[model samples]
Target: MPIESPSRRHVLQASLTVASSALFARAGAQGLTGPAYEVSPWPGPLTAFSLVDTSGKTWRPADFKGRAVLLNFWASWCEPCRAEMPTLQQMADLYGPEQLLVLAINFKEAPARALQFAKRTGITLPVLLDVDGQAARRWGVKVFPTTLAIDRHGQPRLRVQGEMDWTGKAAEKLIASLL
Candidate 1:
């Protein structure tokens, strides 16, 4: 491949600086969810996240800025993930206006199954269908209920793998502060 010219490099750097400065606010992942598991400081934006929710509307990740966001990868087959749905719904109902977006990306599960699970479990959290599983690959999500907390500026603040009491008081305070 040919090398970039000086001017091109300058432009690339400038764009990176801007994306970085603004993106400093948030992210979520697949392999492991938090800063502790990030292989690099720059993980890039969580990719191509647009899915229809229960209400038959499209949703995407970028829409969650200006508030704390949670990105969670789950499957209908995962019991712990199912168990955590109500708590997540409670949080969404609680902090949604403050910009707390919870994107529960259904991994490899049929949209119908995910839809059924959400309704059966009273999971009011917005569910995104990861049909190609590319979102999971991009986020490096290896386990169920892997969660990343993205701040108001859209930076990844906390990442937790495995099940968590997502609506607990401590979690509420941390997420609220980002608003």
Candidate 2:
């Protein structure tokens, strides 16, 4: 059998896997297992946004008023983003939309692609489309899977800058604080 050379996609995937493993290992070693939470990063009004969900319903900050909101910025191609999605859905299910609104804002991806991922993954949370990447930029989400927790009063409270198990105790406590 001839030894086959790896394709660009395969090589990139391998590299990303290695990099992610190393990053997680280093973080674990330093006892940084959960997402990095920044309290009062905005310290003011919630960042305004008007995006449509997979169902073509427009969502705005006002739509989530009086409920704690988790605005998760993610991309279909990001491994961490994909991994954390289930936990996000779990969180959404646990709290219910009336109390905690979990919005998965697709970062710089087409609505069709985002909807496809959601359908394929059985994601019940509202997947909002940020096709132009403007929403992510406005929210200051430079990293994939970054989540911002907004208080019931529509004030941005916490900024989580990585993937996390939303069902975990640390995450539970952090989210409960918003409520």
Candidate 2 lDDT by residue in tens digits, 1-179? 66656786689899999999999999888858644433346564565668999999999987987899998999989998999999999989999999999999998787889989999999989988888898887767787778888888787888887778899998899888889
What's model 1's overall lDDT?
A: 0.72
Compose the digit string of candidate 1's lDDT tens values, residues 1-179: 99899999999999999997666544432333343222223244655667766567787766876777877788988887887777788878876646777878888878899899888877777788878888777877787777767778877666666776767766666676556
Native-to-model Cα distance after best TM-score fit, residue 74 in candidate 1, in Å: 0.8
Candidate 2 segments exceeding 4 Å error: 1-40
Q: RMSDs, each prediction? A: 16.0, 9.2
- lDDT at 17, model 2: 100
Report lDDT (CA) for all predictions.
Answer: 0.72, 0.85
Could you tell me which 10 consecutive residues in candidate 1 have the lowest summed lDDT? Answer: 33-42
